[model samples]
Target: MPVHQVNKTIGEINERIRKGKAVVVNAEEMARIVNKEGKVKAAREVDVVTTGTFSPMCSSGLLFNIGQQPPVMKVSRMWMNNVPCHAGLAAVDCYLGATEPSEDDPLNKVHPGRFRYGGSHVIEDLLRGRAVHLRAQAYGSDCYPRRELDKDVTLADLPNAWLFNPRNCYQNYNAAVNLTSRTIYTYMGPLKPNSRNVNYATAGQLSPLFNDPYLQTIGLGTKIFMGGGIGYVLGSGTQHVAKPPRNERGIPTSPAGTLMLKGDLKQMKPRYVRAVSIVGYGCSLSMGVGIPIPVLNEEMAWFTGVSDADIQMPIKDYGYDYPNGLPRVLGHVTMEELKSGEIELNGKSTPTVPVTSYSMSLEIADELKKWIEDGKFLLTEKQEDIVSL
Candidate 1:
């Protein structure tokens, strides 16, 4: 790979961004430009490359101020649409988790509440303009004498309601295959016993963190398209693991860099951000995130050229005993191989299905570019070198 001297600085990039003259392209188009125009030419032509993702991030929830009632109370216990929410924050604030099921749900008594609706569903309903029944109880403090109350609430009914997800994106995920005799259930979606089907998550080459495996460009305060609203990267996600096995392109072959996303839930569009209940799996929030990377040099242009063929990953046997020992690796496969719709496994061809939506990601990338072009969004200044290796 040929490296060219970079004349562009962070200041220069921001200046172009501010003036709405920055040359920007989505990951897909950038890859094409790099392949045909070559790195040096592409690097100089492109200032920013946008990347995106839409995945099931269970580590998400809603923060709501259920409005000021006559008898104000620091809500200790609460339920919305029959689904319980965590009211442990403050008098006016509450946190409703995506995976949290109703305590009184009968499904909890039997097994994981696969069909039981949770906080995530409530969030979607609110976004859809559906009213949710809100009930709360308090010890009745002198300042807040309310004991119990019931009312219906929507996103409009609350003064402040937004999604504050500590972690929302996983960099690299496992290709799930079941080798067990019985059907196994997992967060990767259900795996058919005996390698009957293969399910993979994440848009490999199009993923934001996958393109910036080293986290060199993406860092805290980076502006992004979160769900339907503009969101910013707060910091490293909860289970962030920077260093992972890499391919020739330096893309991780295992679970690697993750992102913590935050944005205004009220501004979010339900189409781009919604909650889902995967049958027999769990409740999760499906959200879209788009991050733009500044190609300040030729090296970055080369990095942007990474294709599905260059993105390597392992097929983790979801059937294997986890934690006690590493998940057994069934085999190694590239993003191209997986995207081909099939990968040869154990001398037999196995079909691959995607759990996450790639089209959603592509849409986010284009939307983000428009946001920049219209001057509605600006690239945020890096506050810290938090993404560095």
Candidate 2:
């Protein structure tokens, strides 16, 4: 057959393969039949090849004119059954099963190691030549729009950059399990015995709150004022008030009793994106976090040792950091430690996005098509499906 026709047929086959609609056959056995002489037939009757000669029958058990045919078939590679060929497919499994390291594949660019544990190694193999998806939960930083507070203080359209200066900050990590609540409590920083602490009194004095029923008050200091100190002053005028208590997870508990990091908590706001610390290191041991999931089907459950009743959620670790942003921190309890209910200090979680293979495949397919159009590939046909195989 002409190379163009052969390639076109191959391309069509590839398309079916890409979509998981193509039949998989043993290349070696198929080659044997293709090389056989007159009256030759396949040792094992494989799937019939479609043929125009068959007219409405549309199929032929044997390849026609094989003795006079030229070799055109090529086997680039093979994949193990039940394995994933791409990260996005793995992510689909991950998203469904709440798997980790699923989003960290190089194709995805979002390191699951920076977030959680476990991997879909076998699935990653099955998705080869397919698509990939990056599981990025957050895309942009949380924007804190400054609202107008007073006539003199005009709210700027620009954002307020709050740089966390670690050197001046206190830091620590603590873990406890509430027997009564049957929940874990992990604490880091300001509340710790020795943590990079944020001195609320000092920060408040710098920007004292203006007395109003709708606003909290703070204190300020001037060059000529008392001790030149700035902070929040008590109603008594002399004493200072500490910041509100952080929740058990070291998160700021909003008035509504929910742990809030950024955004309007009073409105029961949802922070689609925010900057959170993922993990920290004390120069001692390695740390990590893991999320669990229930297997979806009988086959999936059999291999994963989990049932569909399991939840699928990313296990995020609380974060920590040194005053200088040098030492790292992370929220993690080793499998052994967790089983024993023993815990340690971990770091904060950071903003991230959920990714998958389909998302990546689309990007790759687009680029491939562009490349072909740009003469990057020896493509003769304008129709992409013609190259299926």
| Model 1 weakest lDDT span, ten residues long | 321-330
**Roughly what TM-score does model 2 have, to 2 decimal places?**
0.14
lDDT of 1 by residue, 1-389 (tens): 54467657767887887888899898989889999999889988998888888888899888888777797888899999888888888896888988887666677668855656787888899988899999898988899998998988878989988788888678788888888888877778888888988889888778898777777777788778888887888888888876677777788778877777788888889998778777777688888888888887888888887777787777888787542467567668888888889888888898898988899989988998888777777776667555435
Clash-forming residue pairs, model 1: none
Top model number, TM-score: 1
How far is 90's C-alpha from truth in model 1 (Å)? 1.1
Q: Give candidate 2's root-mean-square deviation (CA, Å).
A: 31.6
- What value of lDDT does candidate 1 attain over all alpha carbons? 0.82
The clash count for each model shown is 0, 80
Model 1 misplacement above 4 A? 1-4, 18-20, 104-112, 323-325
TM-score of 1: 0.94
All models, RMSD in angstroms: 2.1, 31.6
C-alpha local distance difference test of each model: 0.82, 0.19
